[model samples]
Target: MQLQILEVILWPKAAGLPPRRVPFEPGKVNVISGASKRGKSSVIPIVDYCLGSRLCAIPAGTIREACAWFGIRVQTSEGEKIFARREPGKQQSTDEMMLLEDSVLDVPTDTPKKNTTRQAVKHLLDRLAGLSNLGFDPEEPRSGFQGRPSFRDTLAFCFQPQNIVANPDVLYFRADTNEHREKVRTIFPYVLGATTAERLAKKWELENLLRELRRKERERAAHDTVSATWLANLQVWVTEARELGLLRGDALEATEETLIVALEKVLAAGEEGNGFSAQGTGASADEYAALQTEESKIVLDLSVARHRLNQITAVRGTVGYYKGALDSQAARLGVSRWLRTLSNDGARCPICDSAMTSSSGELEQLCDALATIENETHTVSMAPPVLDRDLVDVKSKLSLLEDQLKAVRIRKRAIESRSKAIREGEQTSARVARFLGRVEQALELFSARSAPGGLNEELEKLNDSIEDLRKSLSEQQYALKLDAATARVSKDITRIAAKLDVERKDAPARLDIKELTVGVRDDAGREDFLWHLGSGANWLSYHVAAILALHVFFLRQLHSPVPALIIFDQPSQVYFPQRLTRPTAQSEEDDIGDEDVASIRRFFEAMGKLAAHFKGKLQIIVLDHAGPDVWDQLEAVSLAEEWRGNDYLVPKDWLDILE
Candidate 1:
């Protein structure tokens, strides 16, 4: 992608004064060099603000007080786009902005309300830069929350403010925060064509898939542990129940339903032969028998209700499992259909190397299969509601049976108390029968607690899915080839540094891909890095060389997404003794000394040379306090009229336009 700043316009707060405009040329060094406080440094911030910066970084003073809006015109691959942002009020930023599709030379005279938002403008710019589809979740495991590259993120490489241009620790503009620094490090290779957007996305996908795989492994381990414990307990319970004569010998081979039925029979037999004469309790033996029979009927009803409740629960679980399986099948079928469509449109089949034939019969078959899966999923989904209704009815019936059983138990306890006073002979048989009944109920509960059906099959299917994902991840790992790219970037930075004649034994000699820092060789033949280098001159030199070299690398690549522009603010700061407070034109005879003059000239000369070497493929903009004499002799350098005496980004006439 290519971007050239054609102009920067500052709209006045009132209609009487004209908007201030600064024009720039493409593929050349455009220097806005002159005195202090002439808004020379504000250009970079204005460009950044117009580009979708969340906060307006323009210093609060005369410029902010006078200008109603800030705008910029840039020529891109998609033609010229003009972006205008309202002057931030008291807030840190504003979303309101004006966007035009044409090259706007002047700000509109009418009071133009915001027609778009900052995000909308960024989307258009992202499209021009071929980054519309280039985004990934920053929270992915390996990604470390280094957010995806935005147009502004790339601009951090292109623009260097005075505060950052001379800082020894920082290299890129506004990269003071750790998060911003990580974003620069993570996105540098990608912008240089060492990695692609697709590869980056796939890398994140693989990381997520691996995380999910580990989760499934943990889930399977937990299930196995629980299942083993359940099986062991069931076996012990069954053995004890059989020894107690609560279950018959054939009971060990019984299913859940048969076990429940056996428990019911044992419970019924426990109720028989409770010896009590009605005469002693002032009731007849017939009354006692009738009461026992009623009690037996209620117990049977309670047992049946509990069995029905268990069956309803089991059915609900089965239906839920089937529904989930059908839903997964439907999702896979949809993906397959999408892949087939892509294949028909000239994409190669992923499974086979040959061109995919668009067979109508095959397509029809897939469609039919998809339809069947969808129908099955819908059918299974509906079963949950019916099962829920059945569960509610079963619970209601269980509650009613429980109430009846509670009443019968109360009456039997009272009768037994009275019978105990009359007779105690039948107590032994009754006690044995009750113990057998209790044992049978325990066995039935154990059977119900066994492992769920089809667990192993489900685990096998998940394992197959993980294997397929791993295979796909392996195929897409080609995007991580950063070694060769690092070498190329390192070489380019070294070559550019040499061209600029940055003289320090510890100057940058290589670019580190992982740390995103420049490496240098020391006098001891040991390698050092840029952050350890001393002096503001060396810092400025290394910063400029690294940025220019990266742009050069981008120009050489056929698919690089970096814009071909680099903006520098006061790179000649080291040459100046103190901050220049007033506008003073410098000549060759100025007392600035020869070394300072030479260094300034060399900086501009190197920039001009690189711009010429690229042959209209790169644009360089410099903002400084140097006069025309510093760069008048340089070739292909366009010097804007000095911002010293009367010239400035915001005109003097418009200074009083603030309402």
Candidate 2:
């Protein structure tokens, strides 16, 4: 499925440039080369752009910016020719863009000779190269700057400098990229299996895990805020209770011992002032009076101390009771009641346990005691005016904590919901994983066998059968409609990959490449070349090898009607000319090495094999800055035969050169 360019005609009114004619000689390489910017690369876009590749690398300018106003008359098979041309800013008129002739009109319509150039071109691609209808638009003719099919599909793999290597966003198969692994797996399903799909499934699982962890964190934060708020209010209550003599601080201290010792002295003074039961002389009136006053003071101090101890006990009891109640509340609400409490009742029935029971009578008693303590505490805290300030402070703290708790609960719910979604996602992911694995395995098998099953065609056929059966049975089938259009295109590609494997082996490899990845070791226990030699030879081998592999893949797997043309904008980049010791007087020297020439010869030999495979239907356009030697090799192969077609040199004056 090769396309040979016949003649390119430029319309006078189309732009202003004279029509350029380039011929296609059979088996010959049309070497269009000249000084830099002499429209060497421009020739490619000119042909491609006319054949429905809209963004043909030609800059968007006037006629001068384009490769030049050109009309391309391309011959497919037989005498049929497709005439296509484009102006700078007008739509390509369809009247001048259709098939012109047919050779075997009498034959069956399916025969290649009977078809138009357009149809023939499509047939050659589909039958020989296994290509199908390229993404060419039959309607809505292309206006200048109109979007067309992707350049890769339409342009037939042009290797311009911009696409020399690969980039992340560019979805092309590169040897070093992971995508290549998928390609190889698709091509050699027996070896790689469906690993690429499995990798994607793993990514989905990781996403689920992250979602679950976030849920638990939010729950924990809410619990902390609730606990903090409860503790802060308790501290204020304790302080107020202490001030009202309802509670005491530091019960175990030496200050209490001093007070006790002073009380004992006061008792002794009272005994002395009483004069030992009116018998022995004791004290004067002034001493007796002082002793009585001291006695009264000690009694008052003892009473106050007792009151403080009782109040302290009450406050302690109240706090313990409230804490117990909170624990019960939290337990009912599904909070962690065991937190910070070693004696958390372990699954004990509160009704059975006397100590645990929240009896109404006990609750009332505790409430009354709390109220009394609250009243005393509030009085001590207040300045004899409003108790509302202290109540407001407590209320404010509670409100803030409540708000914090509410927010935390909201966050917790959100997290929990997300976690649930993640769990569901995980389940879905698992199902997806299983599905993908099956698909991958199926793809691998499909690739290995090149059978229709991998294409999921059988599934599609089954669905179609089901629909037909349902239509006949009830005249209305809802379930069948859903599954009827679920054909997997990727699977079809895998099936095709498998089918093409038969031709891949023993397909002539590029002979010029230095590195031949072949098999079997030599007598020296080292691998021997199928045909190896030196460095220059190896370079050519690599180049030819690459081209050969691509050629095989393109012919066997690509299913499109576009012309199979390998346009190398700068092939010399790979096949460098030999260095000369003596400076040649000629501006351009012809000194390609013998090894280089031999490698090139190998490439040609490989080409011969491809031509045989393709039946002389391959078009290779090499645009380089070469001397006569390159043409000499091309001529030796009888590639320069007159019937070959045409060639047009883009004179220096035609285009502006970019330095």
Candidate 3:
């Protein structure tokens, strides 16, 4: 993900004038040193806005008033593309933008129309940078824009403005604000490759699967609880069924879960299975008499139905058997009809030349028998139509009779169950009827829960999926990787810290990822954070070292999405702002001695060395008052433009036109 500004373009508010295209050289520390208020500081905000910052923070004096548009032409790995936007009016920002992508781009003589939007371009950049679209917070990613990393988050590494270049507390760009601060920390691991895109995706999947697994487990557990309750509560139903001959077995002998299974099996079997051996016998006097009378009537009807069904079945079988016999005889006798034709052959058989009269008597008798069988076969086949109708009617009546018998038997069992309760000195009937209704409902529910492809099996499947995803995305595994990666980064911080020679140089320095800043060790090996460290030079050194080291690490990785670019605005500001803190301070720190100049030069000198080390792979842009005398001799540094004397960011001619 190589990104560097080829040019910072400014379209003039005055029409028919060419835009100001300030060229920047790659592979060197490009310098934009100038006097204060020369828009040297404005370069950062221009670049940030063109890169799709939410707010247009370009300074609002001459530069903002003079320019019609703010744009930058950048060289990405995908080749050159120009991003230009109209200057904001009353709004904080504008979605209006001009985007061009190709092997070449033409900077318009006039400011172009609004060809795209800020958010649309940001999404395109996110893809261009190879960023992960997934969020780390698996619980609620949709709640806001905070869950995932954006290409914008990588800008923290790319800029160190005046307020930040030597600041003790805030090291990264926009870290002064809480939103950008917290977001950069969360995305630190991802930006450094400690958390891979695949791992992020898997982590989200695992958490979601675990949620589903827990839901299913709860449901399965509830089924378990319900099944347990069924065993105790269902004993009465089992007794009721056994008494009616709808189920067989001692209800007390069955296991809990198996009782639910038994309920399903017996209900599926209905009254057709062998459950009659356990039917009960007994009742109250009046109710017992009525039960007996009803049982007798049902029994009589069942007997009548059974006799009729048997008669229909017997007749059907007789008709079918008679038809079969007649057909068999008809087949045999038909051969005799053909033989009679042979007897009629004009002079006996062709091969056997015996007299026709000799075979005539036998042929005549055979033909007669054939005629008799054919007639009988037709009559028997005709008997089926009427017999089939009668059979169907009888079977239907039998089914109704059987249902009536089962109901009567169930009522009889109910009476007998009451009789037992009566003998136990209790009264029953209406209560038993209500209990039967409840039992019916429970059995249906139990059947569903204990079914084959039920919640338990689904929960088992979800558990398996969750375990598989956790193999790659476990938190413990990620913690170890993050610790190791931070240690690698800490080594870079310490080496660069030594290179800069900040205060307490003997102590080892480490980047505290939790603190989002660097810390130096004391004699007792207790850490001294940036804010706790004494000198402004010390803070400046640590900040520069940590940022440069992060970029080096980013470049070393095969696919670090952070661009190989760092912008430092006035590294000498710490040396100058110190003077400004005084009541007797001047705008120009004229008392600046050789020592102060040397220390300020050291920061640029270190950046210059890394620029040469990385060569074309790294680029640094410094906006400063540190002029040619400081870095002119440094081979790795080059001045892109010096906005001193009469030169400025917005040309004097543009301001003159406004006047």
Best by lDDT: 3
Q: Can you write out model 1's per-residue Cα lDDT over 1-659, one digit (the tens) per residue?
A: 67888888888886777667788998999998777778888998899999899889998989988888999888875457778899987989999999877544445665457999999988766655655242445244346445556676788679889988877777787778887787877777667665555455445444544554565467567656765665454455455546656456564543445544555554444445455545444663555677789889988988888898888778878887887787777777776676667666877777676666755457668767987887566445434433433554565577567557756765665456435523542334444545554554445334332435333544565467657756764633534556666677777777767755476633448877566667888677787666787777778878888888778777877435577889999888887634332334366555554676777777788889889988787999999887666677797688865776777788877765442
Q: Report the alpha-carbon TM-score of model 1 versus the true structure.
A: 0.63
In order, what lDDT does every prediction score? 0.69, 0.37, 0.75
Candidate 1 stretches with Cα past 4 Å from truth are 103-107, 132-144, 211-219, 229-480, 505-508, 513-516, 577-593, 656-659
- Across 1-659, the per-residue lDDT of candidate 2 in tens digits comes to 34556554443332334544555544334555444434565566566555544344454443334333454555443344544443445443221233344642221111111123333433332332222111112122242222122223423233333233111122122323453333332222111111121222222222222332344345445544654554343344334334433345453233433433332332222222211222111333344455456546555554655555455546546655665565454344332222212124333334454443334444445555554554344223212112222322333344344334444443444334333333332322244324323322322232322355322443344355445533443413322332221112222222322222211222222211112122223345554333332333333333334444444454542122234555555534434433311123343444454454444444444444454556445656555554334444433233322111123244333433311
TM-score: model 3 vs. ground truth: 0.70
| Local lDDT at 126 for model 3 | 75
Model 3 over residues 117-233: C-alpha lDDT tens digits?
999889878766777666767677763435867889899999998889888889899989988888888889887777876676666666656766776677667767887666667
Q: How accurate is candidate 3 locally (lDDT)?
A: 0.75
* lDDT at position 275, candidate 2: 17
Task: Flag regions of model 2 displaced more than 4 Å.
Answer: 12-18, 59-68, 89-544, 550-562, 575-609, 612-615, 631-648, 651-659
Candidate number of the best TM-score: 3
Using TM-score, rank the candidates from best to worst.
Answer: 3, 1, 2
lDDT of 2: 0.37
